[model samples]
Target: MREYLADISRETEVWTADVPTHMIHFNGDRFLGPHS
Candidate 1:
């Protein structure tokens, strides 16, 4: 369970770093249906 949690945390970190560039390149707001 601890290892699994660690993996999830690592993935979240990577996603945080990558999401903005992905959103800019792919127009993520359109797919996400607008932030409120």
Candidate 2:
């Protein structure tokens, strides 16, 4: 996977979830969600 992701910046923002919830994101600006 390193070869495939090597082009992306190391300073890239990351968001991860193992469970499910409602996520509302606007453009590439911000994320609005209950986030619980």
Candidate 3:
């Protein structure tokens, strides 16, 4: 869980422009895949 959250935080930092709203969703979708 910590690793996942850390990765998410790192990804969010890299894509700070559209953080929570856009990039987070895209990142989650990309990492977790369609089924998740």
Candidate 4:
């Protein structure tokens, strides 16, 4: 999946968690990064 994402766009951000689950956020009007 990482390779595919990278191929799409270099600006794409890829993050992986210790668990099997993951999340992604695209350009939006609001903040998409992790929050407190």
Give the top-scoring candidate (TM-score): 2
Pairs of residues clashing in candidate 3: none
lDDT of 3 by residue, 1-36 (tens): 333465564445332333444433435445556764
Name every residue pair that clashes in candidate 1: none
Q: How many backbone clashes does candidate 2 have?
A: 0
Quick one: ranking by TM-score, best first? 2, 4, 1, 3
Model 2 quality (TM-score): 0.28
- lDDT scores in order: 0.37, 0.43, 0.44, 0.51
The stretch of ten residues in a row with the least summed lDDT in candidate 4 is: 23-32
Rank order (by lDDT, best first): 4, 3, 2, 1
Give lDDT tens digits, candidate 1, residues 1-36: 323344453323222234444322233454556666
Listed in order, each prediction's TM-score against the native is: 0.21, 0.28, 0.19, 0.26
Cα lDDT of model 4 overall? Answer: 0.51
For candidate 2, the 10 contiguous residues with the lowest summed lDDT are: 22-31
Number of the top-ranking candidate, with lDDT as the measure: 4
Score residue 34 of candidate 1 by CA lDDT.
Answer: 64
Clash count per candidate: 0, 0, 0, 0
Task: Flag regions of model 3 displaced more than 4 Å.
Answer: 1-26, 34-36
